[model samples]
Target: MTAAARYAALLQWLRSNDADISPKIDLQPSSRGGGYGAFLTEDAVEGELLFTIPRKTCITLADSIEDDACGEGFKALIETAGPGGNTVVMAGFMARERIRSLESQKPGSIVDDSSFGPYLATLPWERGMNNQEHVLYWDNKDIEKYLKGSMCYGEALDLRKEVDVAIRVLNTIVGKSIREFRGDYLDSGFQWPWEKAAQASEEKLKGPPEGLAEAVKGAFVCMLTRAFEDGDGDEEKLVPMLDMLQHSDEPNISHAMRKSDGAVEVRARQDLTAGQELLNQYRSELEETMPYHRFFTRFGFVPGIQEEMTNLFEDKSSIFFAQKAEI
Candidate 1:
């Protein structure tokens, strides 16, 4: 299916599930060059409601633990891993749901497409325009070549190791010895959704699926890059339309989850014109003040760094030397 079809399905499914989406806005290719963004189709005043995703539709850690297939295993994982396990459970849920989505496409299959399938279908597994490309996916060689001497270099290495461990943990849950294949999914022996056709029959393909690890990794990347904190708990939620907006320093939109019903709402922070691409500021004022290297390690991109004029790592080390000299 085309990207437009996938998006249309998402909106249709959302509205059917009681999400209140504004007629004035729609998802379109972002001019910012990072996949799609919500665009205002007509002029709107500040405080106008853009969208409200129902609480049930939000993908949460609770849902992961309650899931029939992996719930018990995930519960054990969380109990053992403590707070950090929340992220692991969510990523596992995403991986399971994605596989179910693919399975649901089969004729007369007992498995049904998950309610989260529509939204999951829209997610990018292989990075393209989507900001799905993250530092975690970078190789150690590249990390050393490009990030060396930068403050984030160590952070990047640590993140890579963490994900490797996470994948191993996920292996115990999925019952497959899934390995990461940096190359194409076909080379990895899995038929991804993007593949035109599977070389094997449906029955043969089900002989323990390939790429579960890759799916887990992709979901982990999504959780890191897209999820928003749920105010009630340590868990984060994958809020649908709200996450579609690209990040910016001067965002035209703001969002809050309603404490009463757990619904998430996004609104215009300023008067917006027709054709304006809605933007969201991922970090708060305090978060924005964090060290630039930490920011890059977390979000995969740094803001406001004029790389041509400054080497922040070198500059930082120079400042340290100067301070020592003064002593």
Candidate 2:
């Protein structure tokens, strides 16, 4: 199906399943930024559904790449994008023009298209907004870093070989194939609905083929196991909904997920007044260096750095490591 058709169908499905909540949502352009997020019209207590966006409604980097091996590179890039093991956990809003251009060109091929021809021909290009290319280039550098790093060496490799084996087996069990789209460059800027397309393209760069949920679960399991081995706790509990909530440092809501069925229940972390926008922190408090920096690094939003504004919670107790060591 064409990208437009697929998007329309997905929107229809969302509207149908979310009949009660759909009307409450205002998907119109956000003057604050170029992306979309949910907001509450009235007071909602803890454990409320807020709104449930179907899995199909969200997008992932895996959706754009054609090969499963690309995930290894992508994961590595994510890791390098931040400090040691505490990488930003949410997917960033990929620039629409860059994504379209990347998809159009064959991997490793020269840019035969015009200087601007390589860009996505979306409406934003016609307007005055600057096409952000640095983010993509940063991701590429991280991928290269991962390719060079090794988890094991020589006979030590034999001891850790099981992890690699597990990852390989999981890959086979949860493989996915994605379709590619060609990028076309047009005018530098445009208006209205055409601009909307640029926003959507950033969110939905590519679509996933069948079995993405299974694939995501399997990958999560493998990563969670490793985290546990490294003194990270029942990290398994955090895996399922990690991707569901997008990143924000100053989150308006707090959430707890039920592991049995991967159900996410959100609650207002603080008292909120009417017309107040809702936010949810995508990563653990221990990892975020500053509140807004999370938005700037991950979503490309300009949240100036402030050392005083660090993540609110941190468990300094060594009990977590002790528990993992006992395991």
My TM-score estimates for the predictions, one after another, are 0.79, 0.35
lDDT of 2 by residue, 154-182 (tens): 21233124324433333322222122223
Identify the runs in model 1 with alpha carbons over 4 angstroms from their true place. Answer: 106-111, 129-131, 176-209, 230-234, 285-289, 304-327
Pick out the ten consecutive residues of candidate 1 with the lowest summed lDDT.
176-185
Q: Which ranges of candidate 2 are over 4 A from the true structure? A: 1-11, 15-23, 53-134, 137-248, 283-327
Question: Tens digits of per-residue lDDT for model 1 on 1-327?
Answer: 788888899999999999999999788887875578889899999999989999888899889888775688899998999988888888888887777677678677666677799999887665443655466666667666656766666767777788778766765665331221211223445557756244323323444346666677778777877899856563688988888787787999888888888899999999999999999987753564555556566765556542421244445543112234554
TM-score of 1: 0.79
Candidate 2's displacement at residue 21, Å, is 4.0
Give per-model CA RMSD. Answer: 8.4, 16.7
Pick by TM-score: which candidate is best?
1
Alpha carbon lDDT at 210, candidate 1: 66
